[model samples]
Target: MSDEGHWFYCLKHMRVEYGPGCPNKDRMGPYDTEDRAKHALEHARERNEAWDAEDADQGS
Candidate 1:
């Protein structure tokens, strides 16, 4: 994707970055907006929890 107006959560620096700052490996994603990038960790955690719940349901 074009790195024009995307946002990323830098895992190495633990901060939100606009456009391109760090390498792709150290970043969370190309979030659509700055606010979403800022909440990357929270969103990841929530997604993980949901996936875990789905797994549990399947196992039962």
Candidate 2:
């Protein structure tokens, strides 16, 4: 978890569908900073608390 301004994506929408709705593919962050993106990941993780949501990890 390095502080680098990047975007962290997550399939929050899919997580809600029980792995069977709308492709379960989505992105969630346009974080202005890497630190922020990481925060987003944590927030989303807390919200979804699943392995799939964790896969939503991305940097850029």
Kindly report which residue pairs in candidate 1 clash with one another: none
| Per-residue lDDT of model 1, residues 1-60, tens digit only | 866699999999999998868999999889999999999999999999999999999999
Q: Which residue pairs does candidate 2 place in steric collision? A: 4-34, 5-33, 5-34
- Which sections of candidate 2 miss by over 4 Å? 1-6, 10-25, 44-60
- Model 1 residue runs over 4 Å out of place are none
Q: Of the candidates shown, which would achieve the greatest TM-score relative to the real structure?
A: 1
TM-score of 2: 0.30
- Give the Cα lDDT of each candidate: 0.93, 0.47
Worst 10 residues of 2 by lDDT: 15-24
